[model samples]
Target: MVVVFYFAAFFVATEFALVQTRKSALESALEAGKGNRRKLQTALKMVQNLNEYLSTTQVGVTLAGIILGWIGEGTIEILIVDALRIAPISETGLHAIGAILGVMLLTYLEVVLTEIVPKNLSIDMPMKMMMLVVTPLHYFHILFYPFVWLLNVSAAAIIHLFGLRPASESNDVLTQAEILRLSRNAVTGGMLDKNDLLYMQRAFDFNDKIAKDIMVDRTSLEVVDITDSVKTVINYYLRQGFSRFPVVANNDKDKILGYVYIYDLIRQAQVDDRILVSKLLRTIITVPEVTPIQGLLQQMIQKQTPIVVVLDEYGGTSGIVTDKDIYEELFGVVKDEIDNVSSEYILKNADGSYKISGKTTLYDFERFFRTKNKNFDESESVTIAGYLLENYKVKRDDVITIGQFDLKVVDLNHNYIDWLEVRRHAASPDEQNAPQDKPAEINGQK
Candidate 1:
């Protein structure tokens, strides 16, 4: 029974270790050629031909089961019958009872010892287990090669006859979910930083997000008229701390012709004084709002265009997105010389909540919030202020309860909300009766 169990455990451990070990890591180990690195290199080569290697493990498991059932059950039953010989009146009845007890014990031991324990141990330290088992498993495979080859060919033939391809000889491809799980496990094992893990996960999800999700809305843009003087445009660009300005015609945003960089204006200013802003304008890429962020990023890279005007479904300029915006979406904020030390869009408070910009997307707001709030109305609006205003039907400066927090429109530009004050609910009766907290003074206003 012990020998049979050892064989079963060997197959179980080998199967998991081969599947779980990362090929890249094994390659690195082989390059280093230190410790068990050589063993891992051999192990990785075997698993690369996954179909044939897996067949060997399957054969080992089957043979172990057959041997255990043939000899193990009878051995245990005879022992039980001999031990109970003095107490039992009929030999036949005693033999029957012994057989039942023997079968139950074998099944229990097989599941616990051969299945659960080894598989879990292998998963926890796959590389280490792979190295340890590779040598013995190699010899076993070689001993059974002829038999295994015959079995594999027959299996592959049958599979092909059914109009299906056999499983690939090597399978290193991982699904998104599998990669995410591995990332999460790395985080748990302290092999990766939480923030880095988040960035990696978001990188994989970049395709799912669209330019509209992260682009700057039109109302928040500081565009310039193409008719404006270079001197005037220079001052405005410097004052606003904008790297580039959209050059529009006749003060109509919809008549945007191109864009001018602040650097270009400053450089050309030294060379010409009487130039119009239009003279310095460079062509900008235009993309639809629904374009995938990843596809847009590739287009920007291939064209060497840094800024793109995002158009709405009706073919009007909705907003603009820059390469910087895509970077922020994947890896968080990236500030430049023009960017302020503190973000104008995000303001932290003493009370543990925030005063967030109304133009900020629900995605950015949630990242700041650091907690999932599924109750927020995502259908009516994509921004925090828009969701609050539309869902609660509130006017400017109105306070509303949203999820587990209190939200107040702290600032407004016409009918559109500009800033909001958020705080956790005052749950106690005394706290509720206490003077309500006023919205924090923002942009030098009460």
Candidate 2:
């Protein structure tokens, strides 16, 4: 009985530990040469063929359970009857009592010793339990190969009958959502850096974003006219501090000829300042505004281009997307020597209000506010400025009330809000009804 119980416990521990241990961790350990090479190799094989080894564990557990019930239970019942034979009771009633006590005692021993204890220990320290049991488990698997094969075949057939596929090696792989959840848990447990977690989260979002989400709007672009002189092109580059500019025909952005690099212009200008900007232009790739950034990134790599022009449905230039824009989307803002050291997207004031840049992404805005306002639609816009434009006719010094917060446009450049002052207001009936400057007209309506 004692030996059979140990056998059952061993299989139970192996079952839980094999499933709980991460295959990546084992592979990493093997690569780093941390443990016994031979043992780690064997363990990896067991994990790779997890279904077969798990079947072997099931077979071992079933056999142990049968043997314990058939031999151990009968032996215990007989002992109980003999030990209580002298008790003052009829033989039939005494025998019945002994039988009941025997079953109860055996059940308690099996559950606590064979099932619960080892299961938890394996869960708590899966890798340690895996190392301890892997060798014996491998031997047991080989010895029960025939039984395990039969069980697996039968299980697969049953699964097929239900129109479901049997489990495979890929079952152990984690999905993107699962990996994100694990990263969050790791951050919570202090096992991962917050910035690393943020980057990982952004990586998942990277594919879902389109070129329109990160492109510099056409209105914000600085272009060189095809008719411009070499000196004029050089002056534009020096003043704007940009290394390259799109060459447009007749000062029309929609008629993009190509792009010109600063080096090309400077080299040409040294020879003759009369050189046309069009003569020094290099070919530029153009993509639709709706193109997925993931596929766009691949195109950029294949063509060896760092910038691409984005086109609208009308075949006119919508904007330009640069490698820097994509990099910032995935890794957050990167400051260079040209960027102001004191500039920030969002700043908290001493009076509890926040001064935020109009270009701040809606995701970061919501994260800082720690609330999701139903009034804002993420699908309609990506930035605070875009969201305001879509929902309200925003103008300089315009104050717009949204949910529990009030947003005042502090600065405006043309039609775009450049900066905003945000304040959270208490939810009071009097405050809601107080007379104030008229709120910005919604969607251009009076």
Candidate 2: RMSD over Cα atoms? 13.1
Off-target runs (Cα >4 Å) in candidate 2 are 78-87, 171-173, 229-243, 260-282, 298-305, 343-446
Error of 1 at 367 (Å): 25
Q: What is candidate 2's lDDT per residue for 1-446, written digit by digit as tens?
A: 88999999999999998888878879999999998888888888888888888899999989998998888778888899999988888889877987898889898998999999999999999988999999999889889999889989999999999999998997667889999999999999898998998989899899889999888889888788899988997876654557778889989989888888888888888899897887887888999999999998999999987788999999999988888888888878765433322247988889999899989877667655654655454457988888898889988899998766899999999899889999997856754564332211111000
**Count of residue pairs whose backbone atoms collide, per candidate:** 0, 0
Best by lDDT: 2
lDDT of 2 at 16: 94
Provide the overall lDDT of each model, using Cα atoms, as 2-decimal numbers. Answer: 0.80, 0.83
lDDT of 1 at 260: 88
Model 2 worst lDDT window (10 residues): 437-446
Model 1: residues with Cα > 4 Å off, grouped in runs: 32-34, 160-163, 169-172, 208-214, 234-239, 263-306, 310-318, 334-446
